[model samples]
Target: MGTVWPDVRLSDSGDEAPTSPQRSHLIGGHDSKSYLAICSESAVNWLKARVSSADEQSVTDIVTRLSRHADYKSTFMCPPKLKQFPEPDMQMAWKYCQEYFDNRVETLFGAIDRRQFEARLRAHLQDGDNSDSDPSWYALRNTIYATGTRLLLTRTGCDAKTIHESAMQYFLNALSVHTQVLFARQVDLTGVQALTIMSFFAENLLGSSIESMLCSNAIRVAQGLRLNYEPVSNERLSPSDRFVGNRIWWALYCYDKHISLRDGRQSCIDDDDISCALPERQASENPNKFEIFMQMIKSAQIQSLIYKKLFSAAGRRQNTIQERAAVEQLDQALSEWRDSLPLHLRPGAPIKKSSLPAGVHIDPVVYMHYTYYGTVIAMYNKFPWTARGSSLDNAAFGREKAVSAARSVVLATRYIDTDMNTTGCLLFSYPMTALIVLFVHILQNPLAPSAHSDVVLMDMATGHFAQLEFATSMQLEVQFVRDMAHIARRAVEQIRRDAWIDVTPFEAPEPAIFSPTMTGPNLNFMDFLTDDVYAV
Candidate 1:
């Protein structure tokens, strides 16, 4: 039998209670050790109030009640309730949130007037008593900044620059808090609250060249966890682990989403889209536009290398292709046998293919653009000179630089691949061939001089590399890819069944060859490969 890892026993074991101040924050002051549960309840109640409110008055009442509670005022909280609010009224909700915060007293709720709510919120946030209880508090402290950002997008209708400038400091603050939460040994309530904060941080900041910063932090945290045998405390580990893992997944997802939204070769926003400017852009594109582009490319290259490493590592841990195919065949045969049973003896008839779960609904244009960006970036940056770069060497000479780079790429690919295989276990098509096509095309016919400049090359290289990293990183995550594909296919089929675009479920398309009419912005990565005639 496989040995289950033993739960870490606390070396400094004690039933000792927290000090008086700490005890005050708990449900009852009976020598309590942690205020996490109360704080969570407070945050949930607070967020629920904010979301359930029909108008600002209701929110104000809720905030007042929250302020009176020790859990709300002294302890930290993160309200996931905000995620459920409808998009249409989110702006108004944000506005109501902000209207109370012209001063430092209250951002959420204080005994003070609406005019002083901001001051009180800031004051409470900055107060020594309520400060630093948990990372979620840090996120809460930054909500005003996010709220301000919402205003910049929806209310003020300002430029990306203005909104970005306004939100940077807060974004950094949240990130700093997130870093602490990720590595904290004694996971607590505040840590779970901080997860949303980290999620937003990854969402906005890790899109451009600075994505390396996010990935580096993630790897470091994971490594730290592996090395440090820490004892789990409270309910923090359960939720925090999920949050941190989910954040990592969403970080990669955001990279994919951003690439799709932005043009293939440029990181700058179109001066119009609300999402074009967030605090992350300011930090990412800091220094200058050229520097930003360079950093972006470098980061993309690093990401691709990591993805490759992870893919290779994962491949080793997972079942072989033959094994997977056999399993699939068995599943298919069993399914057929089940379908063949007599009507009375058969289990409740399975739903037709038409009734599968909803597929992810994504915009065709966005999906296509992102795929193109990733493909192009990978070819140019990840494997700058050649696709068959090596990962082994022992010399210190300049002649070894090429070998070193190759080795580094291989190393990164191995690490990332392991995670995909052991953890993600989802499969998706690789973007390698797509990248190869772009490189070949670029070599055969340089882009028009007018259209192609140093800037374009830099942008294209990074974008392609980003795509390559994502594709390669996820290639071994068989289960996730299958689920995603199944969802997408099912959703498409469902839509087709609607009177709008009537159709039947499609057969799996032929591999290595693509139908011309099926081509669009979001073609699967496999479709970009040249026919067998062009094989290397």
Candidate 2:
């Protein structure tokens, strides 16, 4: 078992409590010590009231029961509670948390009012003198700290085992916080935001089924707050506030679709009932970030349609012409969307073709295009590729379109050095999908022009994923990426074997020989990792 560090354990970590007041703002406080110093008299009163008022007795009762458990052992560590810190460490951790939380906009959580959130945190922090007391507020504070610190560390390339394990301790404690009081009422939007951030982390970490459940909880909370419906102007919310609400709603929508599409399940929020508009662009948010977010939501919307129109019962009907027509419509729409992107947001021509170091900046726009391109590749996979067919034959169209789209994806991955791609597991499908398409088509035409180059490209893509598996914290995603690479490699060998067998007419035929349809293992890795609606 991996080492599990306590939340406030003594350690050799470089970051300790900061003493100088001048150096305070840079460290994320509260996130570390919950609140280092409650500057406001109101905050102090609030903490005092909470500490002296209620929940104290109940905490005592729970601790007593745990210690008296029939099978209790001193060797086992107990679940952590809110630990008080001296003025120094709490101040430091709180500062670090604030800094990290600000970065959450780009790294972990999406589309939050940072100024408002910072205010709420300051409002929550109070002047208190209880080192022995545990409060639910304190628990949530550490939760934020753990989440924020982990996001910061992961993004900054601090893959130290000790750091992650310590962060995990706080995270588990936060999740395991006494829910009896916390969830007694409708969870606030901030609470919902926390759940979403946790869910996102869980997905990156490959936390088995918890990622799905946490995301479900987030959707439920958001709906409870009626965030799914747009708030009218008469409600007195400023236009900016309303826009933030809409952004949060879309964020939930996107996350819901992402999780559901991955596992081939239905999304909780039906698009039919979502009347809220997209967030109005604002000066505060980075335009690039907003563009990427909008693009993902659109992609999620497309994914929903893809599931319903192509992979569901409606799509399974034996109506080829209509299906082709429907697919053609979607294909056209996707192309239009791609063409509509602003020039800078659109994928730029590659800068260089060499392996890039981890710190080298890679354009995120490439991944944006990669997402849509992967979708296009998957669209072609719905119908088997055939060189010979009738005028309206989907098989023939699928073959040519898939081959061309696959080539584009391959070229994109080939030129970009993925070692510098900071997203890690998020874009696992991009290169892997490119590799899959090339693998399938190469099997069919190994002697074709550019086939050898395609093999080298697949190797590069596979190696990129392989390096990511061990280097990144997203163990599960990297595992899946490597799994797809194995699948691609095997596919190549199988194609070669089938070539020999095709010459020996008595030998059995390869399933992938006619593998355009999603039968057998010729699955498109693009959709295979998350959405298997088309799985046979």
| TM, every model | 0.31, 0.63
Question: lDDT per residue, candidate 2, 49-103, as tens digits?
Answer: 3232343332222222211211112222353554333322556456656755554
- Ten residues in sequence with the least summed lDDT for candidate 2: 30-39
- What are the per-residue Cα lDDT tens digits for candidate 1 across 83-122? 2111113344345346324422111111112333345454
Which stretches in model 2 have alpha-carbon errors above 4 Å?
Answer: 1-89, 105-110, 123-125, 128-144, 151-157, 177-183, 207-209, 233-241, 351-364, 382-394, 403-427, 440-450, 472-536
RMSD of candidate 1 to the truth, in angstroms, is 26.7
lDDT of 1: 0.29
- Candidate 2 C-alpha error for residue 401, in Å: 3.5
CA lDDT of each prediction against the hidden true structure: 0.29, 0.48
